[model samples]
Target: MLLENMKMAFHAIRVNKMRSFLTMLGIIIGIGSVISIVSIGDTMRSLFSSLYKDVGLSQAYISIGYWIEDVRDSDYFTMDELDRLKEIFGDRIAYIDSAPSISGEVKAGGNKLKFNLSGVDYNYQNVQPVNMIYGRYLTEEDVKARKQVAVMEAGAAKKIYGTEQAVGRTFRTEVYGSMTEFTVVGVYKKEVNAFQKLLMGSSDDTGAAFVPWTLLTWPNDLIYSCRLFADPGMSREDMNQLFQEIMFYIAKSKGRNSQDFRLTTAMDEMVQVDSVMGGLSAAVGGIAAISLLVGGIGIMNIMLVSVTERTREIGIRKALGATTRDVLIQFLTESAILSACGGTIGIILGIGVVFVGGNALGLQVVVKPAVVLLAVTFSAMVGIFFGIYPASKAAKADPIEALRYE
Candidate 1:
């Protein structure tokens, strides 16, 4: 009996193919919008994770909280204290350094080029490793002796010296109103991925140069901030404990409260970013879901029309001993099938959009199975919820009155 009812419902839909398709249109658009939005959000999260991993997932920073309390010069980190820290936590720490940078113009090969000169130590490479195309990176000797040597990007070297192998070449720049010459000791490859170019524009005339921190700072320079990279083997809990220990050690050594310093990790930044992205996605998705309500109304209107048009058929089925429950189930099944088909099409369309967009942007596409399942279930529920009034109306029709009607 159920099969016969389903067959009749399908025949009705087939006879009015255009109306059936139009009825499904709203559901298709609504589900498509929701799926695309969610998939894009998932892709963005994946991109962020990949980017952070590329840079250094275990990176962290320690900064002096002068805003919390006035910091005395005596409270600053000293070179000796840094060495002691290395001795104490060398195994757990991959690298630790204070990065001091200055922006200036350098005259190389008669071209004035803008450059950012970063001061770093031998351990800097361990934290932020770069591919060396020529010569070598800064050494312990270079930091200790405060050598006037620099490592430049290969592209910058070619612009300055007409070749990527610009090792032993010299470039002059003005520093503090004094002209200083730095010999190029190494050239590293500069990487610019698609996503970076989209964000930072072109990397043409601008380049970076690395020099020893000792050359940039005085013997008594006060260090207010430091960057630290933990060993890859360290867990989040271990890293947190290490941060606490380091803060305590520094506070005790400098005779200040541990609260006088602050530690920020990449994980913390990732969490904030994730929260922001999730909220944005949810807000946009909710807005898109308004179309689903519109689609549900369309379904209800069409179902009402269907009930009125089939009044004579309903009366005949009742005369043949068809139960009201059977009539209700048949209409509900028809509505559900319409919604389910629309949802299936929408899922395909949405996933296609995500894949195309992700490929174009050089991003990874993520379409979770759970999300698809939820969408399918929700769409079916919408059909059933709206079909209730129309289905009930058809079931409660009086056989004599319906039979007498034109």
Candidate 2:
């Protein structure tokens, strides 16, 4: 009997195909919008993870004072402290490096360019491992001997030499208003994607050079930042303990509170970023739900109209012994089937859009199976909730009056 009722209900919808399709339009758009936003959000999270994975995952920074504070000269960390930290951490420490940079002009091959000149120890690459497309990275011997050798970023090499094959080429580094010569030992591969360029705030057309840390003059030289690398298997708690030990020693010696110094770990920052992205995704999805509500109202309105049109049919079915429960079930089934069709289509369209758009943007869209299930289930529930009044009204119809109506 239920199957027969379903056939009749489908027959009714088929008789008014255009109206049924129009009724489902709202639901399709609503579900599609929601799924697309969610998919994009998921992809963004993955992209962020990849961007920081190698460079930041096992990295952290230890610094004294906040940006707003007037830093005293005593705030500077000495080489002795850096060496002591290495001794204390021993094998647990992957690498410790510092980048002390200054803006300087470079002269090479009759081309003069202004570039960022950074002095770094050999371990700097352990934190930011460069893909050496040409020649080799800064070696321990170079840093130890204070060799006047430089490694160039791909963009920097291109600007000075008009090509990435700038290895073995010599460039003059300007220091203290005087020129000191250094040979380019390597060039790193450059990032060309627009998103990476914007996010990293680097112009591929610009140039930069790295030299040995010992070659940089003191008093006038200041370390811009320091990075510490931990072993890959190190846990957050272990990293925290290590940081704590260092901070406690620094604070005690300086007669300051530990909080006075700011230490940040990449793992902590990554977790924070994930939280923020999750909230953003949820908020956007919630806003998109307003359309679902509108779609539900549309379903209810159409179902009410359907009930009115089928009044005479309802009267005939009742005369032939159809019960109130039977009539209610038929209408409810019709509403559910209609909503399910729209939801299924919407899911397909949403995923299709995500894949196409994500591919174009170089993002890997990760579709959550649970989210898809929830959306489909929610659409069916909307049908049931909104179809209740119409189904009840149809069940309560007076056979006598309905049959006598025009």
Candidate 3:
């Protein structure tokens, strides 16, 4: 009986193909929107994990005081705020390795390359995990003694000696108003940020040259970032508070509000970023749900029209000793068929959207299995909820009335 109803349902839907397609359109759009939103969310999660690892998300770094969110905020800190920080915070805080950067040409045996030259303090070794491919990183002795020494990334090594053995090679870098030659003490692998398929050369560690921070400071500007590394077993919040205190004093000394100098731990910032993205994705999902609601309503309306058009047929079946249950099943089956077909198509379309988004946009559109299941289930619910009224109307129709009306 159920199988026969399904066959009849399909027959009815086929008879009005245009109407059926029109009804399914809302469902298609609904599913499509959901798929796109979920795909973007998955991609963002992937980007976050990958970028954080590459860019040193575990510990934050800055050119002035590291709390800066953008370039404009960084500029404000460099005027006079960073200097006052040292005077207030004193030794309870780790030393600030305000290694300013310089852009210049560095020359080796026969290779000349333009690169970003940075000066780092001894504590930099502890602050940042610079993966040395060969040799050793710059040390306190190098900075304090003003030793003619430098560190190179993989690109720099290749430019100079074409090999990691370039550790002992000397390169003359154009320094602050002078030409200086520093022997390469270390060579490190280049760092890359996430969004590998989107942004180019986004990592800070890529193709960099390093000098001692003691030998590098801005002539008259303040600082850019101030990084704070917690001592072992120290809470990140405590360190953050400490950093904020320093920023607070700097701001106060400068006669500005604490907000003038942003204070945030890297972890805090990263979590907030992820949270914001998550919220946006949820908003997209909510919008998609509205489409789904409209689609469900469409299903109800179409199913009711189908029942009305087949009123005479329903009455004949009932007259031929067909029970009300049989009539009910027939109409319900038609409704279910509409939804099942729409749902299957929606699933296919959703998967297609994710595939395109992931491959074309170079994002990790990780489709959660649960989400797919939920979407499919939601479609079925739409059918059931909307189908009931129409199916009941068909079952309750008077046999004589239904046959005579049409």
Candidate whose lDDT is highest: 1
TM-score for predicted model 3 compared with the true structure: 0.72
lDDT of 2 by residue, 113-218 (tens): 8788778788777667778899988999998888989999887888888898989999886765667889999988755454556676766545677888767745
Clash numbers, per candidate = 0, 1, 12
- Sort by lDDT, top down from the best: 1, 2, 3
lDDT tens digits by residue: candidate 3, 107-205: 777777777778777667665667888788888798778787888887667755778667788888767788788888888876453466245453333
Q: Is candidate 1 or candidate 2 better by lDDT?
A: 1
If scored against the real structure, what TM-score would every candidate get? 0.90, 0.90, 0.72
Better of 1 and 3 by TM-score: 1
lDDT of 3: 0.72
Model 2 — which ten-residue stretch has the worst lDDT?
Answer: 217-226
Q: Count steric clashes of candidate 2.
A: 1
**lDDT of each residue in 165-220, candidate 1, tens digit only:** 98999999976567889999999996766666565556677778899887665546
Which is the better candidate, 2 or 3, if ranked by lDDT? 2
Residue 232 CA displacement from its true place in model 2, Å: 2.2
Model 2: clashing residue pairs?
156-207
